[model samples]
Target: MELIARATAVVGGTIAFLRRMGSPAHQAFGATPDIPAARKQGIMTLKMPAAEGWKDGRLPVCAPGLKVNAFASGLDHPRWIEVLPNGDVLVAESKEQAGPPKTLMDHAAQATMRRVKAIGTSANRVTLWRDADGDGTAEIREVFVENQNQPFGMALVGNRFYLGNTDGIRVFDYVPGATALAGSGEPLVAFKPHGHWTRSLIVSPDGSKIYAGVGSLSNIGDQGMEAEEGRAAIWELDVATHEARIFASGLRNAVGMAWEPVTQKLWTVVNERDGLGDETPPDYLTSVVDGGFYGWPYCYWGKTVDDRVPQDAAMVAKAITPDFALGGHTASLGLCWMPDGTLPGFGAGMVIGQHGSWNRSKLSGYKLIFVPFENGMPRGPARDILSGFLSEDEKLAYGRPVGVTLGPDRKSLLMADDVGDIIWRVTGAS
Candidate 1:
C-alpha cells in the first residue's frame, strides 16, 4: 500500500508539472528569467576555496578580519536589521518576553505560535548605531523609536522609512543627522492588520513596488485559509499608487526576501510547517514567483500532501516545490544575495540567518549559512559559514539570528540577534 501511494503521488506531480508548463505560475517559479546567460555562467564559476584562518569555533573577542564584530550591545530582543545611507544600522527589538520552560509533554501537544506572544515587554525599542572616527566600532547608539507594538521589518526608500508591524505599515521621513524619533515624520499606510504579524518589507530593485511578507497564523490548516483575511503570502503594494494585492500565496512563513543583483529575481527563506514530528517537512530557500503557490495547508515541498487537512487537488496541482531544502525546522530567515565583485569567494552567494528552533527534541540551527550560487543560481548544498551561536552540548544558545544584510562597505555581513539583543558584523580576515 505504501509503495502504491508513493507511486501515485509521483505520477500526480509529474502530470501537474506538465499541465502547468509555460503558464505564468510556472514562469514565476522557474529559475532566474531575466539574467543574461553569460553573466549567470560567470556567477556560477566563482568557487569558495576554504581559508586556513576561517575556523569553526567562536572567537575570544569581536575582532575585524575574523568576520565577527559586536556593533551594538544592550538590546532587549532585536528582531530585524536594516542599513542606512550614512552607514547607521537600525534594529527592531520585538520585546516579547520568553515564557516559562515547558516539559516534553507540553511541547508535544502545544502549538508553536500559541505559546509565543507578539506583544513586547517594556524594553521594546528600536536603536540606531553609527561608527564614528572610522575605528570600525560603533561609538554612538541612540533609541530611535519607542512604545512600538511589535515592529518586525523595516525598509528605507528615498527620504522615507517604511516600517511593517503587527498593526499595519507605517512610514517616517528620514531625518538626516537626527538620531532620536523626536523629529521623525508621520505614519503612511494604515491598513487592516493580518496574520503572522511579523511582516518583512522590501522594495523592488527599481523601487517601484513595496513587498511585505505575511506568515500563516496557525501551524497548519487550523486557521482555515478562506476564513483568514491576509495570511501566508507575500503582498506587493505600489509605492506611488498605494495599490495592494496578493503577489504570491501558500507559503507557510516567508520571513525574509531580497532581490538578486545579477538576476533581478526575488528569493525568500521560508519557515515551513511544524508539528509533524521532527523531520516531516523541511524549511526552504527559493525564488518567489508572481501568483505562485508553494504548498502550504494542502501540500508541502512539492507533492507531499498534508493528510491532516482536506486536500485541495486543484491548488496542490499548481504549487511549486522549493528550489532547495534547508533541513527541517531550521527556522531559516533573512536571505541576501552577495553582489558580484563584492566579496571574492561569495560572489552572487546567498547568506541565510538560521534563527534556531524550539520544537525538536534536539536543538538545531543558530548560525549563519552561505548557499553558494553558480550562474546566478544556488549550487548543490549550503555550507555553514558562521556557527557557535549555540553550545555543542545544546544546553544553551547565546543568540537567535533573525535578520542579515551586507554592510555599507559592501564587503562585510551584518546579523541581528534577537535572543542576545545584539548585532554582529562579519568580514573576511586580512
Candidate 2:
C-alpha cells in the first residue's frame, strides 16, 4: 500500500512538472501582468499548509510598530466579523460543507482539504465578544445570532442587522447595546446556493443600500452558465424597498467589497478561475462600476480571453479589466479600508486577508496584506501587515485569515483566523 501511494505521488509530481508553463508568479502582479498561454489542467496541482494551532503563547508576527493578540479564541471556525457601534464584536463562525465526494477527483480534493483541517462541520452561528476594559481581550463571549445557513458576511445598519447566508441575506431588527439578536430574521433576498457558498454583505456609505457578493457556482461555468444565474456578481438592493439590481457582472468569485475612501468608488477582491496555470489569470482587486462586466468565463485582466470555455466574442469584448492583480489562486477574501495613521508605518490603503491557496504548486497568500492606495487607487505591490501564518517549512499554517473589519473601538483592527479558531485584534505597538 505504501509503495502504491508513493508511486501515485511520483506520477502526480511528474505530470505537474511536465505541464508547468505559466508566467512567473511575480509577473502576475501590478495593473498590467504578463499573462502567458493557459496550461493544460493536469490531475490538479495542490500544496496545502497543515492547519496547526499556535502553541505555547505564540502569535502571528506583525509588521513593524504593530502588535497582535487573541481578542477571542476557541471559536468554531470564525470566518467573518462585524463590530457594533457599542464596541461589541460579532464573529461569524462557519465552514464549507463539501458533502460526500462523487468521483476520484472529488475524493482526492476532499482528502487534501481534510488533511489540512480545512473542511469540517459547520458551526452555523455567530459569536459576539466584548472588551469592556479596553484591555485588548474579550472578557465577554456570547452567541449573538443562531440558526444561520452557513453565514459569512455581517453588517449592522442603524437598528437592523444583516447576515449573509449561503442562500440569501437575512435582516433582523436589532436593539442597541444588545449582545444577542432579539428578533427573528426575515429573508431580504434569495440566492441559488452551493458551489461558492459564502455570500458577503456590506452597506453603502450612506446606509441607503446593501450590496451582496455572490460567487460563481463552478470554477468556470463547468456546471453550465444557466446554473450560475444570480451568481458571480455584486447585487445592490435598496435598504427600504428591497429592490435589487445586478450592480456588476462576470466576477468569478467576488468575496470582499469596500468603498475606496478617497474616490468613493466600489472596490472588490475576486477569486479568478483555476487550472489555467499558477499565474496566467490572477485574482484581482478592482473598482466595480455600475453594470460593469469583468471577464469570468471568457477572459480576464483586460479582455485577455480564456480559450478554454466556449467563447462568446461579444461577451468577451464587453469585459472590463480589473484594476490590480492579486496573485493567482491566493483566495484573497477579507478587504477593509484603512485610513492614514490607522496603523503604524502604513498610509491609507486596503487591508486584505488572503485565505491562502489550495491549488497552487507553491504556497501563496497566508497572511494579512495591505495594498497602499494613493487617492483611492492601488499604488504599488502589497505589503505584509501580519505574516508568519505559515510555518518555517511553509507546510503548516498556524491560521488562515478571512474577514477583516475595523474594531468596535473604531481605532483598532480585527481579523478572523478560521483554522486557528481565533479572532485576532491588531493595534499600534505603543
Top-scoring candidate (TM-score)? 2
Q: For candidate 2, lDDT tens digit of each residue in 121-174?
A: 889999889999989899999889888889998887889998999989999989
TM-score of 2: 0.95
Give the TM-score of each candidate: 0.79, 0.95
Q: Return the lDDT, model 2, position 125.
A: 95
Q: Model 1: per-residue lDDT, tens digit, 327-412?
A: 65678887777766555555468889887765443455677887778865787556666776665555445566779988878878
Clashing pairs in 1: 40-375, 44-374, 44-375, 67-426, 67-427
lDDT top scorer: 2
The candidate 1 region of ten consecutive residues with least summed lDDT is 42-51
RMSD after CA superposition, every candidate: 12.0, 2.3
**Ten-residue stretch with the least lDDT total in model 2:** 1-10
Show where candidate 1 strays beyond 4 Å: 1-65, 96-122, 182-195, 340-344
